[model samples]
Target: MRERDIEIYLRDEVKKIKGRAYKFESPGNAGVPDRLVILPGGRVYFVELKAPGKKSRPLQIAQQKKIASLGCEVLEIDSLQGVDEFIAKVCEGK
Candidate 1:
């Protein structure tokens, strides 16, 4: 799916689970993924919506690697179920 489509999907999915999807913006640009999702009870995460069959943008890839190296969680999703799984894992601490 395209990035815009992914954003809509994520926004709706977050709502379904009572979480809030916050798009992380920068003054010039946000090289990271399009959003940071925060759930109730202090659950939170980063998700980059890379199009299906397309490679991640160079800057996003670099940022993701950096975030990983720093011990942060970044989840990439394609289908709705993947988003569901991301929330479930974050909520369950699995």
Candidate 2:
């Protein structure tokens, strides 16, 4: 599926887990993850949605590392099963 389709599916699944997923945009912050997802209990995750069988761009990977360095979890999702597993893991919590 396309990146947008995966994003929509993941956002809908997030809602089922009582979370909110917002399209992330930042002025002058190119390569940032596509979505900022916040779950119950203040857990937060940044998601970069990609087309099936695709990988993140170099700059995208750099942005993910930058975000992770600040102590937030970042997820790269490219499939329906990835979204399902992400939802389940988030709901379960760590």
Candidate 3:
């Protein structure tokens, strides 16, 4: 139940739905979300992956809030079930 394991699962599942889960990194931008998920029909999301029962750090929360202020979707996926729920919600009606 490490963070990387959850990340790999999300990437694999997103691929199954023909989406891309990119490792998102911004140099000099500490606390940015970990993944940039782009689904079909131009749906995009910024995803922060954490270990099971782990919460985001304060700076991460700030970054996520800034992204949300831009009217974009931000997700915090800490488990495989979270990934599945994300796909089911966003990929609905596609």
Instruction: Give the Cα-based TM-score of candidate 3 against the true structure.
Output: 0.96
**Candidate 3: tens digits of C-alpha lDDT, residues 5-81:** 99999999999999999999999999999999998999899999999999999999999999999999999999999
Question: How many steric overlaps are in each model, in order?
Answer: 0, 0, 0
With a 3 Å backbone cut-off (N, CA, C), the pairs that clash in candidate 2 are: none
Best by TM-score: 3
lDDT for each residue of candidate 2 in 1-94, tens digit (9 for 90 to 100):
7889999998899898788999999989899999999988999999999999999999999999999999999999999999999988876774
Tens-digit lDDT track of model 1 for 1-94:
5767867888987887788999877666547867888887776677887666666778878888887788777877766667667767765763
Instruction: Point out the worst 10-residue segment of candidate 1 by lDDT.
Output: 25-34
Query: Model 3: how large is the Cα RMSD against the reference?
Result: 0.8
Lowest summed lDDT window (length 10), candidate 2: 85-94
Poorly placed runs, candidate 1 (over 4 Å): 28-30, 91-94
Q: Tell how far residue 21 is off in model 3, in angstroms.
A: 0.4
Candidate 3: residue pairs that collide: none
TM-score of each: 0.77, 0.96, 0.96
lDDT of 2 at 7: 94
